[model samples]
Target: MKRNTNYYIRKAHRYLGLFLGIQFLFWTLGGLYFSWSDIDKIHGEHLVMEKKDFSTTSGLIAPDSILIKINSRQPLTPIAKIELVETLGEPYYQLQLMTGEYRLFSAKTGHLKPQFTKDEVIEIARTYITFEAEVKETELLTIVSNHHEYRERHLPVWAIAFDYEGDPVVYVDAVTGQFERIRHNSWRVFDWLWMMHTMDYETRDNFGNWLLKAFSILGLITVLSGFLLFGVSYNKREFKFLKIKKS
Candidate 1:
């Protein structure tokens, strides 16, 4: 009876553990990947600058004068979608071209800087003009825009580390051209809470402690079994069996 029970226990443990093992492996690997990607962004030693409103507090330039200055440039084409607005105590303008829009601002001194240099601005204009002129061309940026969506979804995180001065982030509504703040939640205990939940972290009192330990043990067993399954060969014909790949 003892031997029989041991046999069944081992069998049940083996199968149950294997089932949990695959899921645990995926979870742990996914969590590690999340951490690694975040680390790269936070560890980088670059200071990011945001376009600041020197006009509001410093009294550098009046709003009306800035608009008149930019209008004089005449390099901006179409002139169909020039919009001027003041929001959150800052003044900015958006110029819509055939392709995408250009955002320009008046320097604190009331001098207008072309959103791009003369040459750079012309090249950007050319891309839009070419796209508009193409007889059969789908919008060239549609595909690129889709890829950007994927990036934001799959790796939807931005982080900045300590010791860097100046505004680390600039938030703007692409549609509205309004300056805003990007508020990031504090990654403190709440972050740890999530990390623990995803990683199966637990203390002795928590039921999750036993559950996670059991799952981890199962995961380790599964990895070992996988190696064993690959290593064990009953016959030469088993070469084909070992190579059966998973997509």
Candidate 2:
């Protein structure tokens, strides 16, 4: 059995196909899911209530009072942003310090607030949901892995899980007393498919990885070898016979 370039190329194409077929299938599946799925729904837009307007905050204390109060406690701490935000239908001053620290102050009393209590966070989560659902689980997310859904978000958030249709979860900023994110089963499915599309199992967002690169190279070679095989097997005698008959 003498092995030639044709045989080797065909063999390489076959094995490469066997190896990369799964990844290709995953890429196609992920692509189809992503394209067909509504982006807003994937982000759990339909799960949460509509945003409430805080324009009628005439009774709230001025932000200057909150700034003065903050200066007394955290002296010399430079603030990056400040806004009068609402929590549980009450007004609160959200302060983001340049040091990446967040603090909340009572807009009615100008009192510095501690981190939102568990009960407060739960109520905040409840206020954001449009439907009536009982709480399933509540967790304080202080630590998480890189692949976690709430990763890279504000730390020490309150994760309030609900006994809803999608097992939906709402994260509240423990410090700023704001709703951080809403995650549901639909989002989880989207995330999983995104991981496959990117070929990243760990971070799930990295599109350039060694494993993906290797498979991509093998896939390219498989295509190139298939073309070469076709060229090698082409019989020019058939074309010559046709041309002679036409002449």
Which structure among the candidates has the greatest TM-score?
2
Give candidate 1's whole-model lDDT. 0.41
Report backbone clashes per prediction: 0, 0
Clashing pairs in 1: none
lDDT value for candidate 2?
0.85
Summing lDDT over every window of 10 consecutive residues in candidate 1, give the lowest-scoring window: 134-143
Candidate 2 segments exceeding 4 Å error:
1-3, 236-247
RMSD of each: 17.2, 3.4
CA deviation > 4 Å runs, candidate 1:
37-48, 56-175, 178-247
Cα lDDT for residue 149, model 2?
A: 85
Q: Please, what are the lDDT tens digits per residue for candidate 2 over residues 175-206?
A: 88899899998899888888888788898877
TM-score of 2: 0.89
Pairs that clash in candidate 2: none
